[model samples]
Target chain A: MGRTTFHTDPVEALAGVADGDTVLVGGFGMAGMPVRLVDALIDVGAKGLTIVSNNAGNGETGLAALLKAGRVAKVICSFPRQADSYVFDGLYRAGEVELEVVPQGNLAERMRAAGAGIGAFYTPTGVGTLLAEGKEQRTIDGRDHVLEMPIRGDWALIAAQAADPMGNLVYRKTARNFGPVMATAAATTVVEVRETVDLGAMDPEAVVTPGIFVDRVVTS
Target chain B: MTAQQGLPLDVSGAAEHPEPLDRAGLAARVARDVPAYAYVNLGIGQPTTVADHLDPAQGVVLHTENGMLGMGRAAHDDEVDPDLINAGKVPVVEPPGASYFHHADSFAMMRGGHLDVCVLGAFQVSAAGDLANWHTGAPDAIPAVGGAMDLAIGAKQVFVMMSLFAKDGSPKIVPSLTYPATGLACVDRVFTDLGVFAVDHERGRVVLLEAYGTTAADLAERLTGA
Candidate 1:
């Protein structure tokens, strides 16, 4: 079992988060964004952060608030230009922030590969597009695939619906997006849940993320 | 790779067909064409409306890139749950048999070719079936692909839903893409407000299968996608 600690304070749980760290934020958009953790991160005053998420951010809150604070140095995301991604859009246009656009499936699979301890893998997702340029390509069984490497994270900030004392988690609906995979890929995985249940209360099969992958759990 | 050249609807026989469909009409048309019980994904924006037009009895399941399958229609009133949202960040309902998974597994379903059909909105589609929906190639435009590239290449059949002509009155179905490409030779069928088109990537041809409120000859004359 992983030594996962439970926290009541967001700032205290995110105390170790430092500047220039690569942070993987688990959310499809605002749905799974760990709002409390992000707020605490902003309070932690971490600078030059590299954020990885699906959407850049929505409106002037959560991830967008962090980006608006000019704390993010780069964003490695599948989609960065949503309707209210003004904070990121402005920074990108001014050359203040760096961006790496990956195909959505490739982004998810790369993180999955990192967590699964797999080396590089190939897929036909981005083949023949600008994204596959100058990359390794192989003809596997008459189909071409573009080689993509794993993307590891220094810390993962994810939100879930419920968590047990051992850090076993269950998410609600589509909010499960990147949480489970990100929890496995990061060196330190911290989660925010709406409530904490007793141990053994969660069914083993129903747990989206096991306790072994989580390092910290905070009830917010 | 060779697109089968044919028409399900007769455009040659009917001199007077129905008027060009409005947004809802176009969506209904696309929904009607989806194979029954097929696993489908509707892209964001106008393409999302296709879900509303689908008949619930058809058993067509919806897949969202965010990590859901068997997604229901948009959530409204008190049924809305922030956690139960779609790929577009809009609250959605979960129908019976709805399942959730991690991002990796969710996308694997798409890239693994389990999805039967995916309807997407495009900025332009080449005669060779190339998709240019992500970036406009403008110097100042921020490039954000989302799942456009993956869905374009991964789906068994990629159906493009958009107006045939852009707001500037330029045809969206072109001989070649003017914008940065999302995927090459990916689009299978294109359902536009004016007509239905099939791109034969092998022959680099775009065939006007059917037209509405206009004649196929007029579309053929206007479209440079041959």
Candidate 2:
């Protein structure tokens, strides 16, 4: 018989994540976050989570909800400016959250590297100043660059517009922002899709992420 | 006697002639307008080209969001140090007295509005002065909202540098922006390939200040569909 397992509800799926577990979330300013799953994660009350997202959503939504709940220990992203009312600044000022940022391009590449199973790559992105702190700096052919390690998550929470039961997914326009990369870079790739279909139902031309990387699916 | 015999003091060379406009000349013109002794942020690409033309005597302190202040222009090929980079992570030279700080501290300066001027490149500038530089609705493109959003609202004076029309001849300076905004009603002035215009904050209009060879009517017709 073909392998089979029960699909888990969002709350139960995320319940066992301990404090300080690294979580990579997919979205670009409220575009593709698993809003319902995020709410369930908040309900799970996991603290000290180091969240990786493109931008924190507004205070009442998604990742910002976790920030507001005082659950996120750190945020790693490209722009905190997208957060409503500058919550990142407030958290930083209050010592409630630590913040790290990569140039937007490098952030994407790092996620790609993580998914590709590469240990690290040298990029010109953060060679100088504080971004170089505690990282290996090397010079090649008379030019200097720092080695930034790839970021992998213990759990990847990704939102998709569509997902087939076998886990192939498709994202709407800007919703494709960070989903596909996070899907492969996490130990457990939990997918939340607006519509879920049976295996082999989605057209191969439309699939953004292949099914093999996904470990769970939640139909929003 | 020998000097006079060899060359009769070429008066033509001594006489000034109007040099044709070029990228460097345009950059110099932009630099000439930036007030001295101001904290300024320069964006990547075309806007970064403006630094090449900044007069050495001008006391403009450049800030890079990755935590360096007093960044100089691109270094000579022989002087390039890949270790010194700007916010865009391009190799750059640190000017004298350049300081480094934590990323959060750097953002604090921006959020606290310590920057006096920010020069940016834009894909679109709405007639109401909204900026949209990050996402352009391209399928192959990744929408990276860099420091544009912070610098858009953080600086007291926001100056945009871009071509008036995109390569396809569509007006980039528009009556209303279609892309997602970096900041709402935050832009102050625009310096474009066509001309310079001031944002009329109260009236929600773009007041033409100077256009190289075009008129306000012509610009209005192309940009506003007026």
Best by DockQ: 1
What's the lDDT for residue B124 in model 2? 87
Tell me, by lDDT, which candidate is best: 1
What does candidate 1's lDDT look like per residue over B1-226, in tens digits? 1121221222343243569878998999899889999999999889999998888899899999898999988899999998888877788888889998888888888888989999999999888898999988888888889988889888899999999999988888776777889888899988989988777766777767768888776765556322
Evaluated on chain A only, model 1 obtains a TM-score of 0.97
RMSD of 2: 19.3
Off by over 4 Å in 2: A1-8, A140-143, B1-226
Candidate 2 A-chain TM-score: 0.90
Highest TM-score model number: 1
Which ten residues in a row are the worst by lDDT in model 1 chain A? A1-10
Fnat of each prediction?
A: 0.93, 0.07
- Model 1 residue A67 CA deviation in Å: 1.6
lDDT at position B153, candidate 1: 81
RMSD of each: 3.6, 19.3
Quote the lDDT for A40 in model 1.
90
